[model samples]
Target: MFNIYKEMWDRRKMIHALSLQEIKKEYAGTVLGSVWGLVNPLMRIAVYWFVFSIGTRADNPVGGAPYAAWLAIGMVAWFLLNDAFRLSQKAFRSKRSIIKNTPFPIAILPAVQITFSFYTHLILLVVILIAMAFALQTVSVYWLQILYYDFAALMLLLGLGSVTAPLVAISKDFGRFLDTVLIFLFWMTPILWPVENAGPLENVVKLNPFHYIVQGYRDSIFYHSGFWEHPLYTLYFWALVLVLFILGNYLYKRMKPIFLDIM
Candidate 1:
């Protein structure tokens, strides 16, 4: 695990360059170019705000903040995670040319995709902060917890991408399966809806790692709670992350030698 991360650190410059290339390539043909990255998420937020807050007449303030504000915080976090999952799964295949020809560190391929998603994530975060300044009217020191949560999210992505990237490379079927799983996870997570009155189900929902991230974002913004406050939940989250890191590295090492053949 350390070696995988060490390689990623050593090749950090390449990762940054490739991630930038990915962002440019994604918007090359569009007239708006990289502006679309900010535009796309803002548009989604606007549509969701209209549908949930205005259309459905569910505009009640949540936790003393506007529903739109609350939704934006959660959705922003989810967007990063969803994009990272989707892109990182195909990182190896997307850069197959480099992998096939050069002696590149295949492990960093997932990092490249995650880094790309993070660029957009940072932009969306700034938008959210600006929106919060107007909507909430007061800033709390707890907002700094975003840094911790961002680090947590990155670690989770790296761990998950490591495991799934190889699987997707091995079988395109896994990529399709992952899409279905992502949709299911999106609904199961408390992004679109809140989990207020559930009895035992709330505990089950908390078991979802994505829930930890989504809720962490909310906690940072609306709840004004530190991650350390939820000691057991934080412990559970890190324990799961550790497991994933171990499993991901194991899979990467076992599969690295055969990736060229399979691809």
Candidate 2:
């Protein structure tokens, strides 16, 4: 873990540059270009707002804030995480030329995707905050805690990406499997639905690591609650992150040698 992270830290500048290059490459030919990053998610949010808020007639406020405001915060976290996970899995496959020819630090490949997603995440966050200022009409110090949740989300992505990227390289089928899992995770995560008084099912849902993050975003934005207020959940989230980080590094090291052969 130390070695992989140390190398990534040493090559942070390269990672940053590659991440930017990736963002540009992704939208290179589009008329709107990078604007699509913000536009795409905003469109999704509009669709969800229409569906749930209108179609389903579930217009109830969540945590004393408009449902749109609450939903935006959760979606902000999800967009970053989901994009990072999906893109990082392609890190090895996508950068085949670099891997074949350059002495690049493969470990940092996942970080590049995470950073790329993070750029858009920050933009969405700012837009959400502005929307909240108008919608919620108040702000709290707890809003700053979003920085903590963002870090937590990034760490979670790094750990999971490290493990999955190599596995996806080994078998493209794993990438498909990951897609199914992400769909399940999105529904189970309570992003679109309220889990209030969900009984024992709430316990099961919270076991999904993302539940901590989605709820944490709400806590930061709507509930005005500090993360420390939930001590056990906090500990559990970090413990899971630590285990994944360790295991991801272990798998990454074991599989990296075969990546070129498989690709």
Candidate 3:
């Protein structure tokens, strides 16, 4: 464990370069260049907004805030977390050759993918901020609360990601399972439909442990409330995130030796 940490620290630059390489390669040979990352997510959000917010009788009216802005807050966070989760799972798959040959820490692979998604998410966030400033009239220092929103989500990702490492490495089927589970979770989460009161699902969602991570994001970014405003939710979320992180670290360390062998 100590050695892995030391290796990661020693190879920080290499990891960052790999992350940049991934982003560039993903957009390489395309005429639009880096613009494709921004454009692709924007298009997806547009289609989602068109279908759910416009086509259906969903209830996401924000009183004065436009539906687009409301949707951006949630979608941006969702995009960040979703992309990180999906891409990180494939980190080992893509770098299988390196893992097979090198003495490098396997941890760097997932970290690299997460960093790549973070870069793209940052670009989308800038676009969202500009859109909100011009269209929604809701851009202000109060919006800095989004920092906490992002922090909480990253914590959840780190915790969830650590746990997924062994699972994904040992079983390629976990990626398919991950996609299916995320799709199911998308419906369970109130991404399109706004929650009026917590409802029956709210109790179930609260127990989900990730529910507050998403809700806290929407609350902080769109609703412009400090997470401390919901002290109970704040405490509950970090508690779950921390516990999972510890357990994930333990499981990964215990299973990692056999993991590479099996892979």
Cα lDDT tens digits for candidate 3, 52-73: 7768845356644567777767
lDDT per model vs. reference: 0.89, 0.86, 0.75
Q: Candidate 1 at 70: error in angstroms?
A: 0.5
Q: Provide backbone clash counts, one per model.
A: 0, 0, 0
Q: Give per-residue lDDT, candidate 1, residue 221.
A: 87
How much is the lDDT of residue 209 in candidate 1?
93
Query: Candidate 2 at residue 119, lDDT?
Result: 89
So what's the TM-score on candidate 2? Answer: 0.96
Model 2 residue runs over 4 Å out of place are none
Estimate the TM-score for candidate 3: 0.90
Least accurate stretch of 10 residues (summed lDDT) in model 1?
191-200
* Top lDDT hit: 1
Q: What lDDT score is found at residue 108 in candidate 1? A: 90
- Which residue pairs clash within candidate 2? none
* Sort by TM-score, top down from the best: 2, 1, 3
Worst window of 10 by summed lDDT in candidate 3 = 1-10
